[model samples]
Target: MAKRIDVADLNIYYGETLAVQDVSMSIEPRSVTALIGPSGCGKSTFLRSLNRMHELIPKARVEGKVMVDGQDLYAPDVDPVAVRSQIGMVFQRPNPFPTMSIYDNVAAGIKLNAKRMRTSELDEIVERSLRQANLWDEVKDRLDKPGTGLSGGQQQRLCIARAIAVRPDVLLMDEPCSALDPISTQKIEDLITELKADYTIVIVTHNMQQAARVSDTTAFFNLRGIGQPGQLVEIGDTATIFSAPANKATEDYISGRFG
Candidate 1:
């Protein structure tokens, strides 16, 4: 099931340097929220905090809370690995396990978590996930082929399939289409629209048009200057953020006046 996320006073840091500061937002379940900002503004850094992926960096940490379905993910007892299992992530590039077959790639997460499962059940999950990612029709006949063998777009969808195979409650996508062609980007956009019906999705995108097209809500981030921490400028309904943002900085950035 999809899960709601509430972040309060969230500050992400790498050792002594803060990257994103004082971000508080509630992400509705079964919806798409896009994070947009110029390069180095910390949109990706903030996204990484949702699933504790940020902490993978040396000396990285987060202050405040990230609540998923009312449970504090930062609690002492909460395991980051378990948190990641519940909140899956897709990266900027199409990184399918280059050495693994497409079917194995989709089944990887499930195998990592489940002690045992019937082959029939794993097969069913692989098929369902591929279909959900809209890649089944294109790759069904080649399930045993290397995932890297597919086109760039197909490989991305394969990554999406792998993410969903574990049935995560939330999906975090960090520039999932940044390297794709226009057609591939559109396909991923359409897939995001469909996926939100089943998973709470948060995407980071540099493309304003893609953000406008795929997201239900939008969060704009900005920095004061070089070496300054990124701050959330504004967040609201997508239409309002794009058409009538209340913050001048947001309006300026969206209007192409400045980043």
Candidate 2:
């Protein structure tokens, strides 16, 4: 099932330095939300915090609440691993496991979470996930081939397949199309549009037009200066953000006036 996320007064830090500061937003289920910002504005850092991925960095931590369907993700008893399983992530670059075959890449998450499963069941899941990622028809003939063997776009879709195989309720994508060619980027944009029907998606993208095209809601993050922590400037419907943003900074950024 898809899930909604509510972040309240969230602050992300790397040891003594705060990276993203006081972000609060509600990400609706079955919809796409895009985070847009200048480089070094903590857009990716904020995205990682959604699934506890940010804390994986040395001395990284968060101070605030990230709630999903009323459960606090940072509660004392909540497991980070389990949190990750429920909220899967696809990174900026296509990072399909080089050593794993296409089928194994998708099956890896499922197998880790389920100790015992019939081969038939595993096969079904891999097929379904690949299909969901729109990569099944292209690679069904070579399931045993290394995942890296695919084209850049196919590899990214395979990564998406791997992320979705475990049936996560929410998906986090960080510049998932930045490394692709224009045609490949279009395919990914199309895939992202389709995926939101089943998964709550939050994407961080430097491309303003991509955000406007793919997201129901858009958020703009910015920093005061080089060493300053990044903060959310404004958030609203994509149309409104593009047409007549309430914040001057958002308007300026959208109009290519400044980063």
Candidate 3:
């Protein structure tokens, strides 16, 4: 089942320096939420914090609370690995395991989690996941080929299949379409709309129009000045944010006057 996220007084830091400051928001389950901002405003950093990916960096840490369906993700006994398994992530670039076949790429997470299954069971899951990602028809005949051999758009869909194969409750994407061509980007946008029925989707994008088209909720982040920590400027329904934002900064950004 999809799960809601509640983040309160969240602050992310790299060593002694704060990167994202005092962000609080509620993310609805089975909906798309877009995070938008200028370069270096911590939009990506904030996204990573949601799944505890930020702490992978040296000296990176988080303060305050992040709750998913009333379970505290930062609790002392909670395992980060478990948290990550339930919250999948896709990067800006399509990254398929270079050495693995298309079949193995989709099956990697399940195998890594030590879920023993017969070959037929694995095959069924790989097919179903590929169908869900809208890639089965394109690659069904070449499951033995290297995943990296597909076109850029096809590769991204394969990555999405891999992320969803484990049945994750939440999916995090950081510029998933930024590296693809227009045709590919449109395909991905369509796929995102289809996936939200089963997973909580959160994406960080620099393209304002893409955000407006794909998201149900939108959050804008900004910094006061260079080297300043980024903070949430405003968050609300996407329609209202695009049509009649209550914040002047949001208006300026959506109007193309400034970023």
Pick out the ten consecutive residues of candidate 2 with the lowest summed lDDT. Answer: 109-118
Model 2 lDDT, residue 217, Cα: 96
How many clashes show up per model?
0, 0, 0
Q: How do the residues 1-259 of candidate 1 rate in per-residue lDDT, one tens digit apiece? A: 9999999999999999998999999999999999998889999999999999999999999999999989999999999999999999999999999889999999999999964989999999999999999999999999999999999999999999999999999999999999999999999999999999999999999999999999999999999788899999999999999999999999999999986
Q: How close is candidate 1 to the true structure, as a TM-score?
A: 0.99
Q: Over the stretch 1-259, how does candidate 3's per-residue lDDT look in tens digits? A: 7899999999999999999999999999999999998888899999998889999999999998999999999899999988898999999999999999999999999999999999999999999999999999999999999999999999999999999999999999999999999999999999999999999999999999999999999999999788999999999999999999999998998898888
TM-scores of all candidate predictions against the true structure: 0.99, 0.99, 0.99
TM-score of model number 2? 0.99
lDDT of 1 at 15: 97
Q: What's the lDDT for all of these models?
A: 0.96, 0.95, 0.96
